[model samples]
Target: MMIKWFMLLFTGFAGGLAVGCGFVAFLSVLGIIPRLMQLTKTIKWIRLYEWAVILGAVSGGWFSLSPVYLHASHYWFIPIGLLYGIFVGMLAAALTEVLNVFPILAKRIGIDDKIVMLMMAIVLGKICGSLFHWLYFAGL
Candidate 1:
């Protein structure tokens, strides 16, 4: 039982980290956020805000997977988790824009025409991370 729990936790953490990093890298490549905030003083705060958003996304995704991971045995759960992450990420971005919320994040990250692209990257990362556990079970 203890091993099972550990496995679950490990899976969750790995998924979160993978998704977060991938999403951030994709955003940088797309020029949605500055490519070199590491070198810029004014945009330094944006890096912090970006981290917060990615962390929040990872947490949200992990929570979303908890029930399925605990109860389901099907490998399709992996793809489902990925799809869920993508859906949630896109929804979060859209809702934030439509509601005019997340102004702090927007201001810090430097808004561009590529918001949709960035959102897609975030969603894809989330899904890919969750898919790992799904594939693990499939091997079993």
Candidate 2:
């Protein structure tokens, strides 16, 4: 095999974590997360929030797969890719929530969210990377 599974797994996790943290930090700095969290307070804007997540996931899925992306002449590819994107976005949101919610843990653990984010990213990346690797190896 030209690829090592463990390396890919490690790299995926690290890369994902970095990207996730950076994305969250970027959102937080923009005050978007607070605004987003506040959407739960009222009945309004929740739909907007949901739509944002869906859109984010869809966009994420599209970009990530775009690299080695096959030409999708089939109509199903778009919808299917969107579903995968939704999955990615949800997973990413969950990771962001965990780190943002807990500050004391980082102090106590003497580590940072960077590491935590990295771990989370690794998991998300690993899952997705596995799929990618399989596709690449299988000549899909």
Candidate 3:
């Protein structure tokens, strides 16, 4: 039980960090922020975004696995949960971009780009998290 919780926590955190950083990097590549600012100053509010992503992933994973976890071996559900989390994150980012509903901080930073890259990162993160969960279940 404790191990499962720890795995979930770590998976969520790592997934969040990876996706958040990847998205920021993608924006930078598109010249969203000035080069000087991108290289020199640490982005403000990035930590907040990371935490948000982590929490969102964890919650999504937990909720998705609730039924399976309760009835069967909780371990088997980990991978599926993680995969579901990745899909949720990706979908959420894509929908937000489509609707132009990103947090105000994103606009404040002037991160103008294709917007599709952000969506891709989110989806990829969720996939990675799910894969990780699968690996854990396989004891790899």
Leading candidate by lDDT: 2
- What TM-score, to 2 decimals, does candidate 3 have? 0.30
Candidate 1 lDDT by residue in tens digits, 25-134 = 65654543443343234474886757866787767776886765457666766577667775556545544454455554555688665566666776678667756765
lDDT by residue for model 2 over 41-123, one digit each (tens)?
Answer: 64476677668765885588569857766676766765886687765565455545545644555556666756677557656
Q: What is the clash tally of candidate 2?
A: 3
Q: Model 2 compared with the native: what TM-score?
A: 0.34
Candidate 3: give the clashing pairs.
Answer: 82-130, 83-130, 86-126
Q: How should the candidates be ordered by lDDT, best one leading?
A: 2, 1, 3
TM-score versus the correct structure, for each prediction: 0.31, 0.34, 0.30
lDDT of 3 by residue, 1-140 (tens): 99999999999899878977886665455443333234435467567645865687567667875865456776767687667675555445544544456544356666655455655665678678767876887786
CA lDDT, every model vs. true structure: 0.63, 0.64, 0.62
Q: Give the candidates in order of TM-score, highest first.
A: 2, 1, 3
Better candidate number, 1 or 2, judged by TM-score? 2
- Please report how far candidate 3 places residue 47 from its true position, in Å: 41
